[model samples]
Target: MKTGSTYLQFLAAAALAGQVVSAETIAQINGNKYLSPYNGKNVTNVNGLVTAKGPSGIWIRSTAPDSDERSSESVYVFDRNFGKNLTVGDVIQLNGTVTEYRSSKAYVYLTEIINPKLVQKISSGSAATPRVIGKDTLSPPNKAFSALDNGDVFGVPNNVSLISVSNPTLVPRNYGMDFWESLSGELVTVKSAHALTKPNNYGDTWVVGDWKVTGLNSRGGLTTVDKDANPEAIIIGSPLDGSKNPAITRVGDTLGDITGIVSYSFGYYTILPLTALNVVKAIEPRLPPPTTLISSGDCSGLTVGSYNVENLWAGSAHLVNISDHIVNYLRSPNLIFVQEIQDNNGETNDAVVTANLTLTTLTSAISSIGGPEYEFVEIDPVDDKDGGAPGGNIRQAYLYNPDILQLRKPNFGASTEANEVLPGPELKYNPGRIDPQNPAWTASRKPLVAEFETLDGKNSFFTINVHFGSKGGSSSIEGDARPPVNGGVEDRQEQMELTANFVADILAEDKNANIIVAGDFNEFAFVEPLENFLAISNLRDMDEAANIPQLERYTYLFDMNSQELDHMYISQALKPKAQYEHVHINTWVTLAEQISDHDPSVAKLNVCKK
Candidate 1:
C-alpha cells in the first residue's frame, strides 16, 4: 500500500524493529499456510484461494509441509484477507499466492475463493410470517416447527431497525460473521417479502413481527428444552447489524453469533451439534452516542479512570457505552476502583436502579470488560441505603489489580470493640435491624480493606476505601449523626475513630506495614473532629505531596469552586520522593456537568521503606 520514499523509510525502520519481511521463507501462518514469496521473489501481488479468513488474517496451511504434522506445515495468510471466511471446521483448497509478514510468518493475499459452497442459498424460499402481540411482536421460529411452547416469552422481536422488509430497498444487512457458520447472523436478498414494514437508509426494510431466519448452514437459536438459565438457548444475536447493539441492552440480550442451528429437546432448549462463534465480520456497527458521554478516547493516560455508573447502580442499564469509554483507558493500570455501585433490587420495575448502589451490579459491569487476564475484587456493604435515592446508604467501593496486589488478608467482620458498644440498653437500630446486641455492628457500608503485596516491597500495606456518612453539613446529613439516646456528633466521630483505630491496630502489629486511607470524607478540611483525628495521629495526608497551591487541594466541586472533602492519605514513609505522580488536580474540570457531586482523587506514588 505504500507509494514513495516515506514508505521506503517506514519499511526500513520496520525491518530494524524486526517486523518488515522482504523475503522468501516458509513459516506457520494462521492455521498452517506457507509464507514463501512466488518463485522466491518478494512478491506483494500474490493471489490465491481463501483457505480461511479470520481477524488474524486468512488461514492457508502450506500444502508443502510434512504430511504428518499440520502445525509444522504453517497456516499462510494475508494481513488484509487472513481472517476471512474463518470458522471452526471450515477447510478449503484455497489457491491464493503466499506472502510473509512481520517476520517469517506466511500469509495469503487471496485472489479467488475455490470453494463457494459455504453459502446455503435460500432457494427463493417463502416462509410464513409468525404472529405478533402487544407492543412487542412474536413470530415463528427461524426454522419451521410443529409448535414452539416455552415459558411466557417465545419468538424473536419485531425490531424495525435491523429486520427491515419494505417496498423500498434497504442496505445489505451487515452481519459480522464468517463463511464457516451458516447459522451465524447474516443477510440474504429475498426477492420480495410476502409482507413488509418500513425502510432504513441502507435499503433495509423493517420486517416487523417475524420472518424466517434462514441460512440453515450455521447455527440455530433453538435449545434443549430446560427450566434453568440458559444463555446459549436465548442467543439470537443482535448482530450489531441494527442500530448497533443498544449500549443499554437488557442483561439477557447478549451479542452473539453461532455457527450452527440450535434445537430444543426433553424440555430443555439446547443446540444440536452445538456451535459457538469463532469470527466476527470486521465491519463496525453504526450506533448513536450514549446519553451522557460525548466523544471518547483513551483518558489522558491508562493508569486510572472514573465513571458514575449512571448513578452508582452497577446493574444500571446503558453502561455499555461507558464500558467502551473506559476500555480506551484500560491498557495500563493493573488496578481500578469505582464509587456508588448499588445492589440489584427486585422490588423496583428496573432491577438495576442508579438511585442506590449494589455489589452484584458493579461486579457484573466490571466482569464484562473482556480480557481474561484481568481479575476483579469489590466490597459488599451489609447496608446499602436507608431506602430513598441512596435508600440503602451504600458506600464507596474499590477494585484492585490482583496481579499487582495479591490479597494477604481481608476483614469483613466488625471488631470486638463494636460488638461490646451495643446491647447495654443502646439498641440503636430499634425497629429495623435491632440486633439488641450490636446495633452499631450492622455494616451499613464498611471501608473495603486488603493487604496487597505491593509491587515495590516485601511486606504489603492495607489499602482501605470508604464513603463516610453522606450529605455535606457537619451533622444534619450524617446517618451516624444523632440517635436520640447517647448518640450524636460524638457517636458519629466515634464511628470514624473506630475505623481509624482499627487501621492503627493493624499497623501496630507490623509497624513497617504501609497503609492508604482514601475516599470521600464528607467532612471538609476545617472540621475539627475530621482533621484532628487524622492529624493527631501520625498518619500523613497525601495533600502534602501534591505540592499544588491550596486552591487546588479540593476534590469536591460545588458552584464554581472545588472542595477538599475527597482525600487520599498515604504513609509518611514515601513523602520526599515517591517516583511518579499524576493527581492532575484540574482533570475533573474537563468533566463539566457530568461530574458527580464528588470529584475523582487519584495518586500515582509507590510507597517504600526508608
Candidate 2:
C-alpha cells in the first residue's frame, strides 16, 4: 500500500468547498458542489469530510464542462412532478443537499446533483484538478470466474459476485467482527449488499474477506456504528498477515488475489464498489416473452389510431342497431376494440334479439365499410329486462378486420357484477352482465375474446370493448335503480373497477403478454375508475397524444359539449413497439341523420422491430 500526505491533500482539495472533514479524512471523495442543500451557498466548501453512501444513486461529472457551467454541479431527484418529465438516456447530476432516504437500503443520501458530464480535467489550483493516487500498480488477479444467479443473489461473474466465506459457524463466535475491527480506516472493495437476491433497504454488498495482501502494510481501525445484526464487508488494507484466514497478496501490476476455495455458488461473480459504479451498467432481471402465441405485426410501430363507435346495440326484436360510426375500421385492424352494444335475452351480437338484429345488424353495416374480410368477437348476449338508456343495457362489443391480427389465446370472460336487478318491468326481466367472479351467469355480455392467426397467421392479443354503466347519477334514470347493480354513481364506479380488476388479473397471469382495452367508458379521462384502472394494471392510456389540447381531446359529445369519455389503453409490454399514434374523432353530423348520441373514435396503430 502507498503512504499518503500529498495524496490526501490532492483528494481533499477536490471535495466540494465548505465541507467539514477531520484533519485525517481523505480529501478526494465525490465533491461536486451541486449536491444537496439546494442552498445557493456551498457548505461542503468548508468541511473536508461529509458523509456519503456506499453508492446506488452516486454520480460523477466534469466540474466545468462549459464557460457557463460552475466547477461543480450534479443532478438528483426527490420530486415526483419533475421525475415524470425525465426520459431514457438523459444524462443528469444531482443538486439537493445530502439527506437520508429509504431505497433498496437506508444508507447515506446526497441530493441535488446536476450538470451531468463525463471525464473532467483539472487546472492547477482549480477544484477541476483530478484526484490522484500513488499506490504502486499491480497486475489483475487470475482466477477462474464464477457467476451467482440464485434467487438470493445475482451478478455478472468474477468481479462483483465473489464471497469470502460461507461457514455456518465461526471460532470467535462472530470472528468476522474482529476482522472488521482490525480492518478499519482501510480502503476496501465492497459490493453493495442490497443487490443480493435478498437485500434490505440499506444497500451493502455482503462482505467478502479483506483484499488478500502480502508484504503487509499497516491496517487501520474502522469506527463504524454497525447496528446491523450481521455485517459483512471486504477490507482492502491490511494488518492481515496475522489473521487465521488466507491473506490476499498483490501479484499483478494492477490486480491482486487471495488463495481460497472458489465458491461453487458465488465466486467468479463480479462485485463492484457502490460509490464507484454506474447505473446504466446495472442489468435488470427479465422474464422471457410468452411462448404460447406470438404477435408479428409491427402495428405498434405504424400510425395506429383508436376510437369508440357509439351505441351499436340489439334493440326491439328485429331492429339490430348498426351505426355508420364503425364503417371505417374494416380491413386494417392490428386489433380493434369498441363498446356499447345492447341485447335481448341470451341472444347477442348478430343473433336474433327481440327480433332486433344487434351484432348481426351491425356486422352487416361494418362489413359494408370493412369488406367481407371483417368479422367480430363479443360477449354472450344478455337479457336487459328493465330497459337501460340509449343503447339499452349496453356493455361492450367489437368489430374487427381479422386480416391484420390473429390471436394466440384470447381469454374471453365475463365482467364481475352479474345480477340483472334494475327496477320496473323495463329491467325486471333483464339479465345481468359480466362479473368474472360469478360463474353462475357467465353468459352476460362480458368481454368477447377470440385468438386468431393474422392473415399472415402470426400471434397477437385479443381486444376487449366496453361501455360501462353511464353516469346515471344517484339512480338508474330510465328505471328506478334496483338493489344489486344500483348503488348509483358508486355502483357504476365499482362495476368499472371490477372490469378493470378482471382484466388486470389476466395480465398478472403473465405480465409480459400484450393486451389492449378500448371503448366508451362514459367516464371522464381523469375520473377515479379510469385512474384506478391505469394504476393497478401495467397499462397506459394513449389519449395523451390528443389530450394535450382540449379541442384535440373531446371525442364523445353529449348535449353538444365535448368530453374525453372514449379511451384506448395499451399494455406496457407493447410500449417499446409503439410507432404511430392518431385519433380520428368523428363528432360532426353529415347530411345523413346522425345515428347515435356519442361520436365514433378511430386510430391506426403500427408496431415494428427496430
Candidate 3:
C-alpha cells in the first residue's frame, strides 16, 4: 500500500484500539469558513442524533448546538459498504476520520467523515425538533446571491469577474447565499411559503417565505426591478423522500409549511425536504381584459404589436389561445410584428420552407372572432441557416390590416437579399434582410426592414422587425466566472449596433424620418446592446415614452426575475405620439397554461405626423 494509505490505516487502527486524542462535537468539525479545522485528522467518539439517512451515509446533528452561528451542528457520516440500519432520531456515537471530499476540481469540497470505523447506536425515540423560520425566526436577506456577485450590482455586467475567486467572507444576514450558508445542514421550517415561479424540470420550485419582499407583484411574485429586494425567498428542491413533485405549478400557489434540511448544490441554496410538499391553495391566473385605445378614431395613428410566439406551429396546442390573445387581448392592432413563425410542416425535418399554414390559420382565427382579417408579408429564411429549432424554419412576419396601411414595395427583395436603408426615406430592398452575410449575423436571425405608407396616402414611416441573438449559451448567474459570463453578449452588441446604424442611415436622409423598430431583441433594456442603441442612434424606448412603471415593464419570465426580452424603440420623430402597454396575457400565467413565452406589447403611434 502507499505510504499515505498505510499511515491512514495505522491511524484508524490506533483509533479503534482506544488510543484516541479526544472527542469533538459536530460543531467543532464544521468551522466558520470554507475550510474545516479538523479536516485531515482521525477523531473518535463524536456523538449526534441521526436526523437523515441515505444509501451511502447518514447526517447526524448534535442535540445541543454551538452558539457560534458560523459552525454547523450537523455532519455527514460516509459509509462505503453499508449494512447497518440507523433510523432517524437515534442518538449515535461514531469513530471516523474527518475528510474533505470534492466531487471534482471545479466543485466545492464537502466536509464529512470518511470510513466510519465504529458506529454505536446509543438510544432511540429522541425527537429532533426543527427550527421554525418566519418573521420571528430566521429571515432571509432580500436578494438572490451576494453583493460581491459578478458585478457588485445584480444583473448588470456579464462575466467580468468571479465570486469564487473573490472568496468574500460569509455575511449571513446581509447576503442571501451567506445566510443559507450559515445554516447549512440544519433542520429548519419555512411557514406559509408560496411558489415564486413554476416548478423546474427536476420538480424544484423557487419560493418565498411568509415575510415582506421587494418587487412583490399582484400575482405574488417578485418582479425583476432595478431597486427591489426579495430576501425571504428560497428554493425547495426535489424531495428526499423520492416522491415526484407536481409537473406544473403557477405563481402564488400556496405551499404549506415546509420542513427540510438546509444544503447547497448546483448554485442556489436548496432545502431538501424530508417529505413532499402539498399544495394548500392554487391561485387561478386571471387574464387581463382587452386593451382599449383612446386615440384618433380616424386611424391616422396605428397600434403596433410585437410578439415572439416561441416557435409557433400550425397544430401546436396553444395555437387557438395565441390567436385569441392577438385578437382579444391585443385588440387587433393595425401592425403586428410576429416572430418565430414555423414552416408549413411545423418542426418536421423536411425541406418544406413555407409558413403559409401558420400565418393563414392565425388570420382566419382572428376573422372568426370578429377581428380584422389581417394580410401577412414575410421572407422565408434559407433552409437550416437561421438558428432555431432544427427544421422549424422560424422567421419574422408582418401581419398588417391592409385596409389601414400599405406596404411601400417600390422594390422588394428575396429572402437572402440584404436590405440597406438609403436616402430619400427609402429601403434598397423593401421588406428585405439586413446585412445577412455579416459574421455577427451568422446562425442568427436577420432583421426585416419594411417601409410603410398610411392609407391616408399622406404619410410614410419605416419599421424594422428584428430578432437578435438569443441569451442562450450564457454562463450561469452563479457560475465560477465573475460577471457570470453572459454568452452571446458580444454578438448581441454587434447586432444592436448594426440595427442602430440602419436607423441612423434613415435619419441621415430625413432628420424627421418617422421610424419604428420593434420585435424580440432578446435583450433587456438596460444591457449594453440596448445601451449602445441609445448612445449611437439617440432612440427612445417606448416603455419610457409611455410612462410605464419601471418595475412592471417586463414581457418574459426567466429564472426568478420577470424580465423584458421583447421591446420596442421609436426614433426622435415618433417619440411624442407613442403610447405603449405590455398586454400580460401570457407571461404572467402558468407555463402550461400560457400560449407564448413572450407577452405581446401594443404601441400606438401617429404615422401621419413628421
Q: Which candidate leads in TM-score? A: 3
lDDT of 1 by residue, 446-557 (tens): 4455455544445445565555545422211101111101112343354467556655664555555566666656555444446555754457766666564444454343
Against the reference, the lDDT scores of all candidates come to 0.32, 0.33, 0.75
Ranking of candidates on TM-score, top first: 3, 2, 1
Model 2 stretches with alpha carbons more than 4 Å out: 1-334, 344-357, 369-372, 385-395, 407-458, 474-487, 545-550, 577-586, 590-592, 606-610
Ranking by lDDT: 3, 2, 1
Please give, for residues 1-610, the per-residue lDDT of candidate 3 as tens digits: 0125665575456445532344467877777754566766777888888777655567788866778765678777766343166778899887777766543333334667766765677898889777776442457777555655633433456555544455555566666666676676777888888887777778788888776677777777777655333545678887767787775677778988998877756655578888777779887745565677533533456788898888888877777787888877888888899999998878898999989998998888888988788988888888878888999988999998888888876576887778876658789887888888888987788988888887776688888898988778765444445445566888988999998998888888888988888899987776677888878877888989989887778787766666778889998788775789988787656667778878899988887764
TM-score of 2: 0.39
TM-score of 1: 0.39
Q: How high is the lDDT of residue 169 in model 3?
A: 59
Task: Provide the TM-score for each candidate, comma-separated.
Answer: 0.39, 0.39, 0.88
User: What lDDT is reached at residue 165 by model 3?
Assistant: 53
- Residues 34-124, candidate 2: write the lDDT tens digits: 1222322222321211111121222222333322211222222223233233332233333322321212111112233221122212222
| Collision pairs in model 3 | 141-231, 142-231, 150-483, 159-483, 159-485, 161-482, 162-482, 474-487
Which is the winner by lDDT between candidate 2 and candidate 3?
A: 3
